[model samples]
Target: MGIVLHLKKKEMACVEYSFHVPSLEELVVVLQKGLKGNFADVQVSVVDCPDLTKEPFTFPVKGICGKTRIAEVGGVPYLLPLVNKEKVYDLNKIAKEIKLPGAFILGAGAGPFQTLGFNAEFMPVIQIGSEHKPAMNGSYFAHINPADGGCLLEKYSEKYHDFGCALLANLFASEGQPGKVIEVKAKRRTGKLNFVTCMRQTLEKHYGDKPVGMGGTFVIEKGKAKTHIMPAEFSSCPLNSDEEVNKWLHFYEMRAPLVCLPVFVSKDPGFDLRLEHTHCFSHHGEGGHYHQDTTPDTVEYLGYFLPAEFLYRIDQPKETHLFGRD
Candidate 1:
C-alpha cells in the first residue's frame, strides 16, 4: 500500500503559551508582576530537569538539515503532525533520538489518523548556547505547579491550538487581570494579517509585601499552573502570507527582551515584573516536502540571520490603570 500521510486542517482555537527561563532578570520580572496583591505569596525555583545544567552544550546531529549550524536552528517551523503513516515507535525512543534534557517525555498529542490506524506523539526540543537561554510567557495557563503554585502550559498547543496564540497576545498585554479591559483591533495595512491592540486599567493593591504560600486556591499540578483570566480583544488574523509572517517576526524582534519576557500578575496587591523566555515553533508551513539528495555530502544550503527594526509598545501604569497607579 502506498504511504498515507496524516493531514490535519489548521484549526484556530485557544492555546496556552509558555517558555523556559534564560536568566535571573527574566525571573525577577515574572515574579514581581505575579505577586502584587494584599496577601502573602510563595516563590520557588525548580528547574524542569534537575540534572540538566543551566549552561549550553553541543549534541549529536542527524536529518537532512545537518548543514544548518546548531545556533542557526530555531524552533521547528512546521507542525509535525502524526499522519496516517506508522513506523515502529515508542515515546522513550523518540526522546532519546531528540536528546531532550528531561526524562519527562511530554507528548503533545496523538495522530491525525486515529481510526485509520496511526498512533504517534510529538516532543520538541532545542539546543541552547552560551548566548542562548530558555524563557517563558505568562499569558495563558496550561496547568499549575504542584510544589509552589506556578502556572503551567505543558505542550500548550495540544490543548488550545492557534486561537490560544491570539488569546495569549491579549492576556500578556493585559498584565494579568480577570476583568481588565483589553482591546484587539485589526491593522489597516495587511499582507494577509490581523491587528491586535489591547489596553487594561487596574486598581488592585500591591501584595508585594505578602508572604509566600498565601492567598486564594489556584490550580497547580506537577509544574503546571492554570488561571481563568481572559484578555481584552486584541487583533486577529490568519498567519498565512509572507508579509504577515515578516510583520509578526519584526514585531517580536524589535520588542527585544520584552518579547522574551513573561507576563506577570499577582493574587497580591503589588506588582513585580519578572522576565522569562518563550518558544515559538510557528514556522513557515507552506510548500510540500522535497525529498532530494539522500547523500548529505552532495548538498549545501546557505544560512543567514536577518536582523530588523524593534518596536514594542510600552504600557504605562497611570494611563491604563483604574486609579492612575501602576
Candidate 2:
C-alpha cells in the first residue's frame, strides 16, 4: 500500500503518493523502465525526516570565488574562483587538486577554455574526471580530463574573448543520508517544460518551505532547446540584456537521452538562491545551460529525484548589474 500525503500552502492543496524502496539500485530499475516510454514522467523525492539532525548533502550555489571553502569533498576543500577577463582558473586542475574520493559531484558552469566561449556540464565520478564530448556519428565520446572535469560542447565554442561564469555546484558524499522516494508520473503526453513545471508545482504544494534536491537521468524522447556558451572574456561592466546574451546562444532539434540535476525550493532560504536551477547533459554530445524545451508533443521525460537536506550559498556577487540584472 502507498502512503498518501496531503500538503497545503497558501490555501493551495497538493496530494502526493509516497513509496518506500529498499535500496538505490531498486530505484534505478524503476526509473529505467519508465525511460522505455512506460511513463511520461517519474520522480522519486526524498522524504522529510525530522529526527535526522544532519543534512544528506550540501549545495554551493552561485558565483565561485576561489577564496572561499564553501564545502568539502572527501575531506578535501572545494573552492571556485571569481573568473573573469582578469582571472581564469583551470577547473580541471582544481578538480584534480581536490583529490576527492570516487563519488558523484554534479555541477554546471562556464569553461574548458573560457576564451573559446562554452557552457559545461560536469558529471565527474571523482578521481576520474569523465568529460563527455560530441563524437562524429550522433554519439558522445568520453575522455579523461583528469579529476573528472565538466564536459564542454564544441558546437558552442565561439571566440568572444570576454566571458565569466557564476558556477553552481553540489557535492554528495558516499555516506550522505537518504530520504523517502516520491515518484510523480504524468498522465498524458507532455513537454519537458510542462513536465518539469508539474514536478516543481507538486513539490511546492506538498513540501511547502522545505528544500529538495533532485538528481538523476531522464530521457528526452523528442527534444527541442536553446543553449548557450559563455564568452571568453568579460568587462567589469558586462552585457545583461537578453538581446546581448542571445547572440551567444543557439537553437537545436534533438532526440537523445540526457541527464538532469536540479534543486527546488519553494521559499527563500535567506540567501541568493535561484529557487529553480537545472542543468542537463546528454550522450549525444548536445548540451549546455538548458534554456528551455520547445518540443511540441510526445515529449516524454522519466527521472528519479531525491530531496536535498541542506544548501550552502557561496561567493554571491554583491553587484547585480554584472549579468544585466538591476
Candidate 3:
C-alpha cells in the first residue's frame, strides 16, 4: 500500500511566472527556490510546439524521433487486426479491462468535413459522407492512428481545449466505453485557447465524490537507489477531498509543468489514481530521461485548474524588475 498523504483545506494566493531557457544549474535553482508556502511543487510549461524538424533520413536512431512506428492500446496495436470492429471491437470488455467500476463513457462525433484528415489507406472508406457513417477513425480516439489520423491528433493536441470534451469522449470510447462519454461543444481553430478548467470539472462531475477522500499520485522511486525527486516530469493524482486536490495541484504548480483535471478511473471512489508522464517513462537505450531546461521549452501551457491563487504584488518593487524597480 502507498503511504497516504491527507489533503487539508487551505486558502492560496494567485501566482504566475514566465521565463525562457537558463543554464541547468540556474534552472534547478529557479525551480527549487520557487518552492514554499502554496508552492508545493512545480512543472515545466512548453511555450510553443516541440522541435521536430528533421533532415532527409538515411537511417534513424532510437530516441525522441525514432523510425519504428508502433500504435498500441493495452499492448495491442490499433493498426493491426485489433482495428477491426468484428474482431476486437468489444466496448464492454475494454471497459472491464480499464477496471473502472462506474465508467461514464461519451461518444465524440464529427461532421463529414471534419473527417478529412483520415485521407489514407487504413481508413479507405473515410471520404465524403464519412461523417454520416460513424467509423472508429474520427468518431473515436485519434491517438496511435495512421498518418492522416496521427497528424490530426497532433494538431488537436495543440488546441486540446477545443477538443477536450471530444478527446475524453473518444479516449474513453476507444477504451471500450464508447457510449455515455462527454464531448466539448465549442469549436477550436488555432492554438490560442484551452478548456482545462472546464474539462477538470467535467471529470469531477462524472467521477469525484465526497467518499473518495483526496489523493492523486505519489512519487515512485527510480534509478539505482532512486534518490532523485524527479524533475519537470508530468504526473497526476485525482485527490479525494477538496484539500487533497488543492494540495496536489499546489505541489505541481511551483515545481514542474503540470495540468490537473478531474479523472474517474473506477467506481470504487477509493482508487487513488497514479499518473506517470508517458515521456518520462519512455526512452530507447537510455530509458526515459529529460533535459532540465529544454523539455519544458516546448510544451504550450494547458490552463490549470487550481483552487487557490498566488498573485504576487510587484508594483512596490523588490530586488529585481520582476517585482518592480530594483
Which candidate has the top score in lDDT?
A: 2
Candidate 3 lands at a TM-score of 0.20
lDDT of 1 at 210: 28
Which lDDT tens digits does candidate 3 get at residues 1-326?
12222223531111121111123333223322322111223342222212211121100111111110111121111112112121122223323323322222222211111232321111100111122322221211222233322211222222222221200011111111111111121212122212222222333433344211110111111211000111111124322343432332211111222111121121122221111111111111111111121222232322211111111111111111111000
Q: Which regions in candidate 1 have their CA more than 4 angstroms from the true location? A: 1-29, 34-89, 100-102, 111-326
**Cα RMSD to the true fold for all candidates:** 22.8, 14.0, 21.9
lDDT of 2 by residue, 167-264 (tens): 43333222222344334333334334444444545444444555343443233545554444333333234344556545533334334455444444
The local distance difference test score of each candidate is: 0.18, 0.35, 0.19
* Candidate 2, poorest ten consecutive residues by summed lDDT: 69-78
TM-score per candidate, chains pooled: 0.20, 0.52, 0.20
Angstrom error of the Cα, residue 121, model 1: value is 9.4
User: How many residue pairs in model 3 have overlapping backbones?
Assistant: 33
Residue-level lDDT for 290 in candidate 1: 14
C-alpha lDDT of residue 280 in model 2: 56
| Preferred candidate (lDDT higher): 1 or 2 | 2
On residues 219-278, what C-alpha lDDT tens digit does candidate 1 reach at each position?
Answer: 111111111211111114533444433342211111101001112222221221111112
Q: Using TM-score as the measure, which candidate wins?
A: 2
Q: Give candidate 2's TM-score.
A: 0.52
